[model samples]
Target: MRVLVQRVRSASVTVDGEVVGEIRPATQGLLALVGVTHEDDATKARRMAEKLWQLRILDDERSASDVSAPILVVSQFTLYANTDKGRRPSWNAAAPGPVAEPLVTEFTDALTALGATVQTGVFGADMQVHLVNDGPVTVLLEL
Candidate 1:
C-alpha cells in the first residue's frame, strides 16, 4: 500500500459533475491518494491509516489525531505506474479493482475508527479533485 498525503486548506472530489466528497479545514487537514499493490492486505491498510491519522504534518507540527482533522481519501491506482521500460506506462504493479477496493475501505475505516472525519471519492470512477494546498506540504508513505 502507498499513500500520498497532502495537507490542504480545502478540497473536493467531483464525479460526473456531482460533488462526492469535500472538506474545509478549520484547522488544516489531509488529502490522501491511496494506492494498492498485489501484496497489500487489511493489515497494511490499517497500519497506513493509523500512520496518516497520526502523522504530524500540519501547522505547528500538529497531527490530524491531535486536532481531529478531516481527511479526504481517494483511490489512485496510477501510483503504481511503471514508466521505466518505454513511452507507455505499465500498471502491472497495481492490484486489480476487486482486490483493491476492500483494502481501500479498510484503510478509510481504520482512519474513521481512529476518530478522524473521513471523506472519500468513488472507487474506479473518473474524478476531478480540487484543493487549496496548505503550506504546499505533501508527504508520501509506503508499506
Candidate 2:
C-alpha cells in the first residue's frame, strides 16, 4: 500500500456536481491519495494508515494521532503508474478494482479506527477534488 499525504487547510471532493466529501477550515487535516498493488495486504494497509496518523507534519509538532485530525482519503491507483519504457504509462503495478477496492476501504477504515475523522471519495467514480495545501507539505508513505 502507498499513501501520498498532503497537509491541507481545506479539501473536498465532488462527483457529478454534487459534493461527496469535505473537510472544513479551522481544522488541520491530511488529504490522502491512497494506492494499492496486488501484493498489498491488510497488515501493510494498517501500517501505512498508522504512520499517516503518527506523522508529525502539523504545527505544534504534533502528530495527527495526538490531536485526532480529520483525513480525506481518495483512491488513486495512478500512484503506481509506470512510464519507464513507453510513451504511455503502464498501470501493471496497480491492482485491479476487484482487488483494490477492498484495500482502499481497509486503509480508510484503519485511519478511522485510529481515531481520525475520516472522509472519503467514491471509489471508481470520476471525482473532482479541490484543496488549499497547507505549507505545501506532502509526504509519501509506504509499507
Candidate 3:
C-alpha cells in the first residue's frame, strides 16, 4: 500500500458533476491519495490509516489526531505507474480494481474507526479532485 498525503486548507471530490465528498476545514485537513498493489491487504490498509491519522505534517507539527482534522481519501491506482518503458507507462504494478477496491474501503473505514471525520470519492469512478494546499506540504508513504 502507498499513500500520498497532502496538507490542504480544503478539498473536495466530484463525480459525474455531483459533489461526492469534501473536507472543508477551518484551517487544515488532509488529502490522502491511496493506492494498492498486489501484495497489499487489509492489514496494510489499517496500518496506513493509522499512519495517516498520526502523521504530523500539519501546522505547528500537529497531527490530525491532535486537532481533529478531517481527511479526504481517494483511490488512485496510478500511484504505482511504472514508467520505465519508453512510450507508455505500465500498469502492472497496480492491483486490479476487484482486489484494490475492497482494501481502499478498508483503509477509509479504518480511518473513520480512529475517530477521524472522513470523506471519499467513488471508487473506479471518474472523479475531479480540487484542493487548496497548505504550505504545499506533501508526503509519500510506501509500506
How do the residues 45-132 of candidate 2 rate in per-residue lDDT, one tens digit apiece? 8888888899999988888888777899999999999999979999999999999999999888988888989999999999999999
Task: Residues 32-77, candidate 3: write the lDDT tens digits.
Answer: 9999999999999999999999999988999999999999999999
lDDT of 1: 0.96
Global lDDT of model 3: 0.96
**Which portions of model 1 show Cα errors greater than 4 Å?**
none
Cα-based lDDT for every prediction: 0.96, 0.91, 0.96
Clashing pairs in 3: none
Look at candidate 1 and give me any clashing residue pairs.
none
Worst 10 residues of 2 by lDDT: 21-30
Q: Residue 10's C-alpha lDDT in candidate 2?
A: 95
Which runs of model 3 end up more than 4 angstroms from their true locations? none
